[model samples]
Target: MFTAVFNSFESGMIYAIMALGVYLTFRILDFPDLTVEGSFVTGASVAAIMIVNGYSPIIATLAALGAGFLAGILTGLLHTKGKVNPLLSGILVMIALYSINLRIMGTSNIPLLSQKTLLTNIQDAWAKTGIDDVLNGLLTAIGLGDSLPKTWSILLMMLVITVLIQVGMSVFLKTEIGLAIRATGDNEAMVKSFSAHTGNMKVLGLAISNALVAFSGALIAQYNGFSDIGMGIGMIVIGLASVIIGEAIFGAKTIVRATLAVIGGSLIYHFVVTLALRVDFLQTGDVKLITALIVIGALLLPLITEGRKVKARKKKRLMELQFDHKSLEEGK
Candidate 1:
């Protein structure tokens, strides 16, 4: 159970990065960018290919980030220059990326089981620096000696990355251009009235969004030791789930709080999925269905709660009216 939970946490943190990217386009820019599905695979494909070709893992990951940025740029151009609808522009880029990813990888899958990935290198350094021994001792002192997770080093690394990205995002959103992006989402006409190029803001917002998403993909490919072409299937839904779940649980009243909530939501989502898969009758293939149900539940929770509140108010009002009528009748 401990190992399972730990694994879930790691996966959650990685996917949280992608969720942050999704938040930018969906929540901030109000852009229905389906390019995420394709950009994610593009990141994995680029990183996997570069790693297989004996490039440094760091270089491969950076290359993947660049590739993802380009994919976002294409989608942006299609929407802004080609006069395509935002939704259709994303769809077109997504379709094109499927072929582009295939060409980059030269196959449908690439395995890095024996290759040196970023996580593997981190593990090696951890062992060399005696950090594992220190961690083991700390766990023993805490009566968790037997529960010491083997993935602790990797988990720590991911935690650091997640925190850095969150901080970066919080800071970025407060910048002048970031304010423009938010304004563009809230009211494009108002932003245009202020002399801001709404089109440029949309394109830049998407570029940043997809870049973060691809970065997540690169990390996931390395962490899992493989990158499959279909790995990005249903990614947009997952991202939305994370964002909605975070906002619902954390209350997005502020940017910093919202970003933290998104990360927390991702962790909760992974934990729920992990526990569900532990059921005896559940199969691995049911993950997508489970995700869909989770999203539905998250999306409907607020409405359900609000409905109950409304009913309670109405009941109270009715009782008060009845009491007033009784008082009038008694007086008469």
Candidate 2:
């Protein structure tokens, strides 16, 4: 059970990167970018093919990020320049990426079991440096040696990466261009009035958003030891769920708080999914359905709470009015 929970947390941390990208578009840019599903696969497909072709894993991952950036640019162009509806532009790019990803992989799936991935290399270095022993010693001294996980090194690496990305995003969002992007999302006309090119902001924001998402895809492909054509299916829903869950729990008044909430929400989301899968009637095939239901529930939770608050306020006002009427009658 400990291992299972730990694994879920690790997965959540990885997916949190993608969720952050989604938040950029969905929340910051107010762009309904459906290109995520395709951009994600583009990242995995590019990374897998490059790695299989004897390229360095880092190089392959960077290439995936580049590909995702280009995909986002195309979508942005379609929406901004070609005058296509934003939603339709995303759909078109997503459809086109399906073929593009297949061409990159030259097949529907690519296995990476024997390949050296970033995670494996880091894990190897950790073992060689004897860090595990030192960590074990610390845990033993604390009387928790038995609780130390075998994949602690990988977990640490992932945590560090996630934290770095979060910090980078927080810093970037405070920059001039970043503020412009946020402003563009909030009020395009106001940004335009300030002489900022909303179109360029949209393009830049989408590019950065898809780049992070693709990076997550590259990491996931390597972690899972394979990349499948269908791996990106329903990614948008998962990303939205993570963003909404985080905001709902952590409150998104500040950028830093919002990013932290995204990471926390991802952990909770994955843990819930893992727990649900343990049920007797749920099979692997039901995973998508479970994800959909989880997203629906998360999306509705805020509305449900708001509705109850409204009712309570109304009831209180009614009681206050009744008290005032009684006071008037008594005074008369």
Candidate 3:
């Protein structure tokens, strides 16, 4: 059980990066970019093929990020410069990437079990540098050493990496360019009135968003030991689920809080899914159904509470009116 939870935590950290990317487009930029599914596969494909060709894992991962960035730029240009509908533009790019990713990979899947990945090398370094010993000692003291096994190294590394990305996102979104992107999402017409090039902002925002997503994909492909063409399917829905769950549980009133919320949401989603799959009757194929139910609950919970509040307020007002009428009759 502890191992299951730890694995979920590690997986959640990686997915949190993708969630942050979705939050940028969905919540920050107000762009319904379907390029996520394709860009995700693009990242995995590019990274896997490069790694298989003996390229450095870091280089392969960065290349994937660049590829995803270009994908976003295409979607943005198609929508802003080519006079295409935003949704249609994303669909076109997404469809195009289906072929592009296949061409890059030269096959439907690429296994990285024999290839060296950033995480694998980093794990080796942890052992060489005695970091593993120190962490093992700490874990043993906490009685989790049995269930956790060698996962401490990975958990620690992912924690630092995810926190760094979260901090970096918080910093970036507060910059001048980031503000422009936020304003564009909030009111495109108002931003245009201020003489800002909203087109450029959208392109830049999407480029960054997909870059983060691809980065996550590259990591996931490495961690899971294989990158499959079908792995990216339904990724957009998962990302949206993370954002919705996070924002609902931890109000996104500020940049830091919002990013933190995204991370928390990702963790919660993974944990829930992990536990649900352990049920005797539940099958692995039920993940999408679970995600759908989670999204529905997150979206409706606020509305349900607001409706109850309205009813209570109405009742209170009626009671006060009745008391006032009784006092008037008594005075008469």
Candidate 1 per-residue lDDT over residues 236-321, each given as its tens digit: 99899999999877879999999998898899899999999999899999999999999989898878887998999999999999
Please provide, for model 2 over 1-332, each residue's C-alpha lDDT reduced to its tens digit, 9 standing for 90 to 100.
Answer: 65678789888999999999999999999998999999999999999999999999999999999999999999998888998998999999999999999999999999999999877888888888887888779878998766676757777888899889999999999999999999999999999999999999999999998998899999999988999999999999889989999987787999999999998888889998899888889997887888888878878888988899999999999999999999999999
Off by over 4 Å in 2: 133-148, 306-332
lDDT of all predictions, in order shown?
0.91, 0.91, 0.90
- Lowest lDDT sum, 10 consecutive residues, model 2, at 144-153
Candidate 3 regions with alpha-carbon error over 4 angstroms = 133-145, 305-332
Ranking the candidates on TM-score from highest down gives 1, 3, 2
Q: Summarize candidate 3's per-residue lDDT along 1-332 as a digit string, tens digits.
A: 87788799998999899899999999999998889999998999999999999999999999999999999999999998998987888889999999999999999999999899988988888777876677668877988777645646677788788889989988988888878899999999998999889999999988988988888999999989999998889999999999999988897999999999999999999999999999989999999999999999989987887799899999999999999999999999
Error of 3 at 36 (Å): 0.4
Model 3 RMSD vs true structure: 3.2
Off by over 4 Å in 1: 137-147, 307-332
RMSD of each: 3.4, 3.2, 3.2
**In candidate 1, what residue range of length 10 has the lowest lDDT sum?**
144-153
TM-score for each predicted model, relative to the true structure:
0.91, 0.89, 0.90
Give residue 225's error in model 1 in angstroms. 0.5
